[model samples]
Target chain A: MTKRIQQFLNEQKPATPCVVIDLDVIKNNYGSMRTHLPLAQVFYAVKANPAPEVVNLLVNEGSSFDVASVPEVDLCLSQGANPDNISFGNTIKKEPHIAYAYSKGIRLFAFDSEEELLKISRAAPGSKVYCRILVENEGAQWPLSRKFGCEVEMAEDLLCQARELGLVPYGVSFHVGSQQTDLSQWDVAMTRVASLFMTLQERGIELTAINLGGGFPAHYIEHVEEMPAYADAVMRAIVGHFGNRLPKLMIEPGRSMVGDSGVLQAEVVLVSRKSNDDCKRWVYLDAGKFNGLAETLDEAITYRVTTSRDGEETEPVILAGPTCDSVDVIYEKKEYSLPLGLKAGDLVQFHSTGAYTTSYASVNFNGFEPIKAYCI
Target chain B: MTKRIQQFLNEQKPATPCVVIDLDVIKNNYGSMRTHLPLAQVFYAVKANPAPEVVNLLVNEGSSFDVASVPEVDLCLSQGANPDNISFGNTIKKEPHIAYAYSKGIRLFAFDSEEELLKISRAAPGSKVYCRILVENEGAQWPLSRKFGCEVEMAEDLLCQARELGLVPYGVSFHVGSQQTDLSQWDVAMTRVASLFMTLQERGIELTAINLGGGFPAHYIEHVEEMPAYADAVMRAIVGHFGNRLPKLMIEPGRSMVGDSGVLQAEVVLVSRKSNDDCKRWVYLDAGKFNGLAETLDEAITYRVTTSRDGEETEPVILAGPTCDSVDVIYEKKEYSLPLGLKAGDLVQFHSTGAYTTSYASVNFNGFEPIKAYCI
Candidate 1:
């Protein structure tokens, strides 16, 4: 925990199962991204953590936003973001919501399919639209299924058709995947995107932008390379593929912007063994998959844990949330060690959980209120 | 869809991505339980769907409650349920919450470990405590992990210790699993419980209640046995082992009590293929895994769907929820067919969603509101 978060926790002592976000950390992350990737314009992905405080801070930092819904557009604009700086980045949007966004003065949007493009044309006329082409999500810890993007050839046709539909075929976009580790995936993506640009140019549609959809990782159980390394690799990929004719670059950083900025403090609800001679321990926490840690569904995003009884003898334990549902078990197959002395009421801190945790909490599953987040 | 739900949808036209629950269906389901399992007292599990209307109706019907949290206890009480009819069924609970439940006049509790039992004794002294023994989850579609119940031998010792700790050694409970298809699993659980009862009787503690933890099936894609069939098997297992001296039987029904009562109405946001030549269509809906259809994770529960274009020629489609996250894909591996003419703005209804649908919705994962529930 940072001194700021530690001091806040000590002084306020908010109830267990709440997250404390350090604003200074988000500001610092923004600064690091800017310094490392100066060529790219930063579009903060609001779905990662749409806390007003985070948005306001990013707004002050002159950050553009990659919004997924109309509410996000309203949120960003309410916090003093220029509509020009907001991009409706979700490919799947309701036609009415697109109109609502357009009415609010948002001009940029993303679409993966021709049907969605038609909706955009009818709703947000002359809006700058980008086609998200499907790219390999190999080497990502949380690999994205082929849900968001489309084939490169189809994207080329979509852009050519965009002109006829009275929409600006701005550029192309692709996601390597969330928490992507291998830098070579970006190389492959950039190469494919460069070919698409060449193909589109031949079709008389000049694309001006390239949305490098969020694939940059946050600190997880695995050792993640810093922004500098990712920036270096991304810049190399762009420069190596595009040569002198560089397109306007946009990077939507969701997890990297705020993931490490918060710490989720949960209390141990129960600790037990199925049998007396059972070697493994079962540790149940107050917060669970429904409340916050939904990323732990497949044990995909393992948050580094620090307990109140740290430094005590540790042993592998199965972690679960305090719910009646059996699927609420956090980590059973993966080995996670906790202090042997850890018992009910012991505080457990999940680190680097600022991004996806709070936003994914259920309304009142099992009568537990959504996990609370306190931004400092 | 039921005529009531269909009529309510036509009249209300509330919005896309909402659950319309027919209270009469819940009443009928409750009535079915009473008709089939006349011997066992029904303890309606509130976590499945804690809609106040559902609770109030069950309360009026004299159904006892199985609450997992303090809020659930309060919800049941607020709905005119007697505290004596409520059971703190979750084995994993905080000590303070236990005290709160006790303060609110709750006495029954569930426990699997010594630590939890110790807490209950300190917090809610002299409570009617039951041991949850681990049982096979082999035949369950949604098999519960060992996060809940303990080893049968360990459960025996725990019940014996419950007496020593000043708490009433009430009974034993075991869950076959959620969405359980196999009836034989109940037989195995009962035989073990019968053996435990004999062991406890010899030890001079007279256990009364035998909690047949919920494993009842709700309507999904698979054919489910009628309530009478399940009730008969369960009663036979109890009578076959205990002979003339049947223990006080308690059945906790969550899913079966409420599952078939709801119809989730969602609009198709977009319909597209990855490529023009792609074999399957990708259909996006306003509701998804984070919203009403959480059981669709791993395609565990395949809901029967009715589209506005239902009569049109159908084709196998990849179904996904409307979210930026790739993990939001609802059913990819499972062969879910949709109307060939299905397009944006088409209404699709997912049936048998009254239980876990609205309860598991994320608060604001992608700036989209939680799936709304309206009980009529």
Candidate 2:
């Protein structure tokens, strides 16, 4: 945790459980991602913790946004984001919502089926649409063959249908999955998407952008591989297939860009002994499954607990929350300790909780207030 | 599903994701609980579903409530529920919220420790307190021996301390965990609580109530044992321990009262084959881990889906939701069949989702609107 964060934690009233974003960390992350992927324009996936301040920071840093729904698109627009910079990345089935997006000048819409093509034709008329193709690859973290995309075989028909409707088939896109640690999966997807784009060009359809939808791994724990190598591989695959004529690459990175830049802090309310002789203990904090740290079952992502007090050595402690339900536990039997004298009134801070922590999670369980974010 | 419920589903506007509760079923469940424990006054745990309409129905039926938080207490009070009838069953350190409960004439509170007792003495002077005793029965269903309660030996000290502070020590309480099926284990808790009450009486502390904090099992699935016989055995043990002098018995039944009363109606968004033979067909619904169904991690409470169409023969299908996260799956490899023609936009309802279904959970994952209840 940063010194300014420690001082902020010390001064907080502790009346409400909240998520705090270190704008400096976000700036660093944005700067690093830009430097690494200089060729690819980054569209910050606002679905992961879409606070106005977070969105504003990403917008100020020259990052576009990938919005899945109207509310998310509206959120970005409300934060002073450029309409042309926003891509409605998810397949559109809701005709009215699609028409609204088109009216707002969002030309970069993703389509995966004839039904979506018809919906887009009827709703957006003459909109420049991106055909979302399924890139089936073995050994990838998550095969895109699951749902919500046109099969490699169906891509031609879908693109032809868009052309028949006079819709601009601007590009191809594919999302393998979220938290995809493997870089080989991007190479496989790029290879498949490149071929589809060439076939479309052969059919006399000119494209402008190829969107590699966001699924970049957001590592919370240390020692997880960084993404610069993966980004390089993806760039290589694009050049190998489409050569210098490869459309402008657009990568919408959600978790990676913001996951590690935020911290959620709550006061410890109770602590219990794991065993009579076991040194480890279970500490119950005010925050629970209701907020950002809800991926308890999927232990791939976890927050690192730190004390605001300086020079405090860490000990392993299982963190529980205040909800009455047993499943309300935030972390499963993990060890992370705080200050030796951490008491009821003392605050415990969790790092790397910015992404998908608060924007999508706020139910007000136990009458606890929603997370309040403080940027910078 | 009832005819009225089917009609309601047909009339509802097409929304991708929503939770619909049947008011008629809720009333039926509430009535059924009264029939099971005819002798004891029913205090419907308001934490189960604190919606004003839901609370009004339960209160109008002559059922009091057991509230765990100030907001819950305030909710009941707002619906005209008498404060004297409600008990603050949570056993933790009281905040300024305690003063509000006291001001509302909520005299009853639960206590588990010496530290909590001291705080309560200063915060809520002269309040009627219930000593939450921790029964040291290893075989006890949930031995809440962790966190909230005092040991059986500490009961003497607690009773003495309550008297010393001019607070009314009117009763004793014990919880055998939630959704516990072991009737024999519950008997052990009753026996221990009864014995502790006898010891307190011998020590000149006359109690007026013995609260067997409710853990009555509701067989959400088939072939599970009923709770009536268990409740009878527990009552018999109380009578056996104290003879005719047993205090006014109270039970904090949360799930049993509302667990079976509610069903969640979700729209099928998409259907696809999970296996080549279509033997593993997946019917994706709108409800996911964000809702309460995800709490049944070990199949403790299983929800069965039924279509609104008549003669809806069941076909085994895996259920998933629209969330991008892989873990958003609600039913994995679980077999359930819906109507043959049931496709996207068709309504499928899950049974036994009343109590902890919506009130105890939320759409914290996608930040969607909270579940709305219909009283039809």
Candidate 3:
């Protein structure tokens, strides 16, 4: 275990499962990002970990926000973030939510469809709008399907239509997919953005900015390239694609910024063999898919788990959450080894789980309390 | 559209996505279960839908509760349910929770492990304990994995241990799996329970009650046999296996009791083709996996979706939720047909969504509001 996790465990001594976020690590992560990409501005994706403390820390570090909804805009604004620095990143939004964000003085927004652009025109007139281009998210840890962006033809039409409807055709944005590991994915997305930029330039529209939506990978169970390596690859790609005429660039880093700053501490509810003849042992934890770790869906993100009982003989076990729901098993097919002496009341820590842990927690499924977060 | 749904849409005119529950349907479903299984006591599983109105209505009907946690016990007690009618159904529980339930005058509980039995003995001494026996959940609509229950030998050992630990070895319980459609699955499970009962009796511990844990099916896209058919099948299987020496019988119904009583109304955010050359259309709704319809995990439960503009020309479309996440796609592999006229601001209703909808909702994911429910 890292010193940060050990210190947190020693201090908090949590009886119930809780997420501990180290703000100092977040600050260091922010500094590292700024040091690597000197020209690019950082807009922390608020949806990843919307804890007010996380937002406030980023705000103190002079980070902008890429908000998805009216409440996200409000969360950033409430934490003293400037509304001018916030962008509505979600393409599919309710009209009233658009108006609500507009009422709160958020001018920049993202849209993919003509209907959405029309709603933006009506709700927030003359606002800065970015059209997202659909990209292949192959090899991404969490491969996003066709959900947010439109095709190149649709993007071109949507941008031109935005100008016709009295909205500023501000820029282009694209997400390579969350927990994106491969650096070449950024090159592919940036090349597409560059092509769209030139197409729009030929159409006599001068775009002012390029919003690089969040896809930065976090170190979980697997090793990823360092932050500076990703930053170097991104900067080199942008320069190679756009050369000297790069638009005012911004990168929204959700998982990369916060994933390593927190650790989730959950206690073992029980450890038993299902049957005497059964091969594997079952270790059940107090926290599960519903309470905090909903990102464990389909085992997309594999978090490294460690128990307080260390340096003993280890055995492969099927990890499960403390719920009557059978689907709540966290790890079964995958081989997860834990100390053989692990039993009930032992603390188990899931490392590098800050980003998607608490934000996706359900309030009361199977009557378990939502995962609580404590910031240090 | 069903008259129940049409009346709801016409009457409520919900501007945002909401769950509409018909109390009359719930009352009728409860009455049907009682009529079909006259000998079995009803313990409505609170985790299905923890809506206060549902609990209070069931309380008025004198229904017992199979609660998973202390808050569930408190919810029942606060709703004026008698302590004797509530069973602490979850085997995985914290020590404080057991003590709290005991302090609240709850005596019936379930356990499947030695550690749990020890905790109960220390906290809630002499409580009526049930040991859940593990069985193959074959052919069930939602086949549960090995997250809950233990094997026959484990159950026998645990029950015997419960008596030695100063607890009442009261009964045996087993879940055939949620949304169970196969009647023969129950026969196999009950036969195992009978064997365990006889073994426990040989050890001088008389097991009085038998908890036929929740598995009852609900009508969704596929047709299920009515309540009487299920009850009759269950009765026949019990008589065939137990041979008239049935213990004090109880049935915990979660989905079947309330599933058909509710309808979820969500407005279409947008309807568009992925590209000009693409064949199928994509229909987006305000509610998705994170908010209310979490039962869509792995497409285990296929809900029937309809819109107010029914009977119009229809086309196969991909359905998705409003969140920015890619995994939020509700239907992609499956072919779901919707009206071609479906557009922004049009209302779509998902039928038979009363159970497991709102209770599993996250508080705020991508800043969307947690799904709200209303009762009539």
Candidate 4:
């Protein structure tokens, strides 16, 4: 556990099975991003955490927001973020939501489909729009298959359609994938964005910005390159690809910004072996995929787990969430070792889980309360 | 689409991306189960749907409930269900929850661990307890894994311990698995239960009930044998395994009881091909994993999807939920054919989604509202 988390736990002794976020850590993370990418504007992805405190902290830090829906726009706006600084980032949106965002004076938006572009044109006439191009998401811990982006050719057509439909064809964007580890992936994605920018430029549509969607990774179980290293790689690639013709660079960092800042203190509900000769021990925690930690789906985001009991004989165990549903097992295939003497009431602190944990919590499953989050 | 759903849509024209539950279907399902298993009492698994209307209907029909938490117990009580008829079925529970349930006059409880037994003993002393035995969940669509239940020897020990702790050793229960297809799996599970029952009887503990637990499959992609056939098979297995002397039989049916009774009407946000040569069309729905239909995690539940444009030329498409997250792609690996002309404003109805759909909905992700459910 980090010293900060230990200190918080020692001081507060918060009820088990709650998310504790350190605002100071978040401030440091935001500062690092600003220092590393001086040329790039940071837009915090609200869907990752969406905690009021996290949003307010980022807003106070002079950061913008990448919002997906009308409520998100409302949240950012309520947090004192300027509407101009918020981008309606979701490509698939309801017409009413589009109109609501427009009514709120939020002009920046993203779309990958012609229909979506048309919807935006009708709902928010002449709004600034960015088309997202689909790219191969290789080496990403959480690979985004074909959910958001359109093909390069289709993106070009969509941008042309946007301009013809009276919507401003302002920029291009693409996500390398969430929790993306390979920095070279940005080089490939930026090259594609630059090529698209040049293509649009030839067609007399001068783009003003390039929205680099959220993918920056957080250090969890695996060692990841620091923010400065990612920034250097991104800057070098932009200069190599776009030269002096660089548009306003923008980045949406969800996980990297808040992931390491939050710690989940979950209590061990039970620990037992199914059979006497069974090799694996089962450790059940109060929270699970339904309550929170839904990112554990397929074990895509491996959270580094630490128990209060340390330096004891360790054994690989199957970590499961406390729910009636059998599918709530968190770590069964993956090898996760914990102290053999671990028992109920022992605090197991999951590190760097601020992002994607609380936001994905279901309201009630098997009657368990949603994972409570506390911002310190 | 089913005539009932079409009629409901044409008449009510409810907002898209909502769950429509057919209470008549639930009534018929409950009646059928009661008729088929005359000896077995039906405890409707509230976690499956938990919709107030569904619970009230079940309560009015004099059905029991298998609840997992205090809130579930409260829901049942609020719905006018007798507390004696509701069993606290979740094996892993907090002490406070046990105390709360006990204070509410709930007596029947289930546990699989010594720590849990102790908690129950302190909280709900002298409560009727059932020990679940871990069984091989082979041929199950949604396998339980090692999340619930313990070994046969351990179960016997636990039951004995429950008696020593002044709790009534009420029964033995086992779940064959969710969406279980093979009926023979129940026979195997019952045999194990019978053996344990005999062992417990020899040790001066008479088990009163046998909870077959929830496994009873719902009609999804495959045709399922009717409730009568399942009840018949279970009766024969019980008769064959235990001869003339039989315990009071009970079943907790979650998916099968309510799965087929619900229909989800989701609007197509957009449909497009990623590339010219791309073989599959991508169809985006307004509701997704975050909003509801989370059972699509690994495509465990294959929902039968229908569109308003039925009878039009059909094409295999990659179905996805509307979200900015790339992992929101629903059926990329599995082949799903949809109307070739499906577009925005078209309605796509997912059948047999009544059970797990609304209950698993997240409060808010990407600003999408939880899938609302209406009972008709």
Q: Model 4, chain B: what is the TM-score?
A: 0.98
lDDT of 4 by residue, A13-55 (tens): 9886789888888899999999999889899999988999999
Candidate ranking under TM-score, highest first, comes to 1, 3, 4, 2
lDDT for model 4: 0.87
Q: Please write out the lDDT profile of model 2 over residues B1-376, one tens digit for every residue.
A: 5677567667875453545556776677667666766667677777666667878887778778888677788888888898888988776434566677888888888876665566677778999898886654343233333554656777766877899998988888887776666666666777777777778878888888888777775445554466567667777777677787767878778777766666677776556552224455566666765665655543445676667563856566667765545555666555566666666567777776766666545444443455556555
Q: Enumerate the candidates' DockQ scores in order.
A: 0.93, 0.26, 0.73, 0.71
Report, to 2 decimal places, the DockQ of model 4.
Answer: 0.71
Each candidate's chain B TM-score? 0.99, 0.87, 0.98, 0.98
What TM-score would each prediction reach against the true structure?
0.99, 0.84, 0.96, 0.96
**Fraction of the real A/B interface contacts present in each candidate?**
0.98, 0.10, 0.71, 0.74
Clashing residue pairs, candidate 4?
A: none
Clashing pairs in 1: none
TM-score, first chain, each model: 0.99, 0.88, 0.98, 0.98
lDDT of 3 by residue, A63-114 (tens): 9999877789889989999988898888888888889999988999998877
Candidate 2: C-alpha RMSD after superposition? 4.5
Choose 2 or 3, whichever is better by DockQ.
Answer: 3
Residue B9 lDDT, candidate 1, scale 0-100? 92
The best candidate in terms of DockQ:
1
State the C-alpha lDDT per candidate: 0.92, 0.69, 0.87, 0.87
| Model 4 regions lying over 4 Å from their true place | A1-8, B1-6
Quality class of the docking in candidate 4, CAPRI style: medium
